[model samples]
Target: TQLLEQSPQFLSIQEGENLTVYCNSSSVFSSLQWYRQEPGEGPVLLVTVVTGGEVKKLKRLTFQFGDARKDSSLHITAAQPGDTGLYLCAGSESYGNKLVFGAGTILRVKS
Candidate 1:
């Protein structure tokens, strides 16, 4: 089975701080998807990196896919209060159409 696990189940920091969240797995995946979800809302797609070693950036956020397609990372720069939310990493299995999500990393950025 392909499973993804994220580090630091919870993170709390003051505004303007920087942090990195990691997603690792023992099995390979065809693609990796990054999402951020706010309270009571569905997760919003942040980025989707398909190639190994691929990197994508959105605003103050950076995402990277592992060379073996078994891991990924998210880096946030100058975090703001609005950045506080649940961060999830999902990986698509070899045959399934559904994505298996990680335990999630809950982040809190206080002003």
Candidate 2:
């Protein structure tokens, strides 16, 4: 079984700060997804990357897939208190395959 490792399991920062979180795996994936979860709610899909070196942006958030498809990163710029939540990364080995999830990163943005 493959595992995705997320770094800096916890983070606490002031509002308007910029931060980056990472997810990495030894195995390549056909696609990778990023999600955010708030208290008492299920994770909401943020973005997905299928191509190597692909980058996507949503508002102040940026998502990137590594060249080998074995890693991914999420960066938040000028983060706001609303951004406080759990960030998760999931990868699938093939189309329609089961997804392997990383442990997750917890972020707290204080106003």
Candidate 3:
């Protein structure tokens, strides 16, 4: 079983809405990654945070890693239909490269 925790198993929002999701874990990791997956395809890594208290942004999406290295968060601004997908958070112990992923959060953005 995976070790990470993801909140909001499903979310639906109108275009232009802003939303946030979270991933939490009690175990410390060397790196944490966020991914977005579309139907019938593998997920695309959105960002990877290797340092505690790190933050990264891609267009309207913002990602943050907790200072304790055991949690992370993703925030989307001005949601669009193109942003609809399954969002997953994964973590790996220091350089182990064996990822443990959360159950995924399904987001549906309506225009």
**How many backbone clashes can be found in candidate 2?**
0
Clashes (N, CA, C under 3 Å) per candidate: 0, 0, 0
RMSD of 2: 0.8
Candidate 3, residues 1-111, lDDT tens digits: the string is: 448989999999999999999999988988999999999999999999999999999999999999999999999999999999999999986765689999999999999
What TM-score would every model get versus the actual structure? 0.97, 0.97, 0.96
Give the lDDT of residue 7 in candidate 3.
Answer: 91
Q: Pairs clashing in candidate 1?
A: none
Q: Which residue segments of model 3 deviate by more than 4 Å?
A: none
Score candidate 1 by TM-score against the native.
Answer: 0.97
Predicted candidate 1 versus true structure: per-residue lDDT over 1-111, tens digit per residue: 678999989999999999999999999999999999999999999999999999999999999999999999999999999999999999998876889999999999999
After superposition, candidate 2 runs with Cα above 4 Å error: none
Model 3, position 78, has a per-residue lDDT of 96
Model 1, which residues run further than 4 Å from truth? Answer: none
